[model samples]
Target: MTCQLRVLGCSGGIGGDNRTTAFLLNQNILIDAGTGVADLQLHELRAIDHVFLTHAHLDHIACLPLLLDAVVGARTAPVYVHATEQTIQLLRSHIFNWLIWPDFTVIPSAERPSLIFVPHELGQVEQMGELSVTPLPAIHTVPAVSFLLSSKASSVVFSGDTIGGTDFWQVVNQVASLKALIIETAFADKEHAIADAAKHLCPSTLAKELKEWQGTAEVLITHLKPGESEVTIREVLELDHIHPIRRLLQGEIIEF
Candidate 1:
């Protein structure tokens, strides 16, 4: 079995020629269908069978309607959407409420809905073919989650918009074979006010958060606002070079 990571969208928003936050696991397993799904080839896109969401943020969930529209009839199996119960409710009420967009869950047929909801508890580990996934809590405007993904060759964590907590670091320190991390730093030093209000990571704060980590995985940064990516990255890189740090790029394919 092939297990690889395809970054569909890595930016915080659909700005600066970048798409919003989204990722694909082994091409068929999706994580947060942000605007980046718009870029997938039609045939390749139709092959997706699962989508794991991080939160109810518009940037993270924006592409669900569009993606469903694209592959509605083409999918042979239902697209399993896994998330916390609250996240699912928000998506159903706010996003797919028929007023904002048609509720795909009730579409076509109730028994064979295009999108299938699978409510998962935090810290519960589930297997999808060759992938084993666990959800970790994240601090955000709404209840959010980061993902711990493990395959035979390696394991990694994706911090989906968090403010860095003890639980997060505890989990990171426990993973023995973590190969990389894709964490967020959304604003520049000058935008500290905005970052604070939104509870997002600034470069300086992110540097402090990294102190908790002891693993040797590449500390790849992501979710920078449109134009502030470079400055924010430089600031975070200023920290002591214990682990390799780099900025994540859109469409970059990472192999374990």
Candidate 2:
């Protein structure tokens, strides 16, 4: 079977056509349930069988509730949401509560509800259909994880919103057949204070983090803050790195 990873959104925040982080693996899997999912047609939404969230941040899971509401009746099985235990709880306590949104896990009936939370630990290689997904270490304000998605032929790692850590780079360094690294640099050098406070990355810190990566995969930067794209992009280019760096764009496709 052919394997494809499509970028539905990679922006730090939303405006105009820019959207928060989200990716589609083949047709049935989603990397995150961001606002970008709003663009998917009904048939496309119904095809989603699994959603892997990096964190419980609003930007990363903005569309999950709506996604379940849109596709619940169209499919026979509930959509599985895989994440760290903390993330799952936050989703339940904050986003999925009856006040904020009807808890889909009990919506129709608990026996055959529309959503299921599957908590996974770091480094667990979970199988979802044809792909093998492993969670990598991450340092963000809330509990978070980066994901390594591997098909038999090639692999890809997404460095969800984080201040890159030594363990993260160490694990990714050992991944073979890694084709791409979709990492984030969420702010400009001047706003690095904000980045550091939020545990996200800026060009300067991102450059420092890249030194730990000893992989050959092309680096695609994601999550640049809305109005500062031009300055951030320029700053990112001047950084020293072993691998080629490119800006991840919405609707971009990487076929491996």
Q: Candidate 1's residue-wise lDDT over 1-256, tens digit each?
A: 5468889899987655799988888878888888888888998779888889989898898888888878898886778899999999998888898898888887788888898899998899989888888998788888899999889888879999888787899888998778898899999888988998898999878888888888878988989888878888888888637779999989788777
Per-model TM-score versus the true fold: 0.96, 0.98
List lDDT for all candidates, in order.
Answer: 0.86, 0.92
lDDT by residue for model 2 (1-256), tens? 5479999999999999999989999999999988999999999999999999999999999999999999988899999999999999999999899989999999789998999999999999998667888999999999999999998888999999999899999999999999999899999999988999999999989999999888878999999989998899889999855679889989999876
Supply the global lDDT for candidate 2.
0.92
Cα displacement (Å) at residue 15, model 2: 0.8
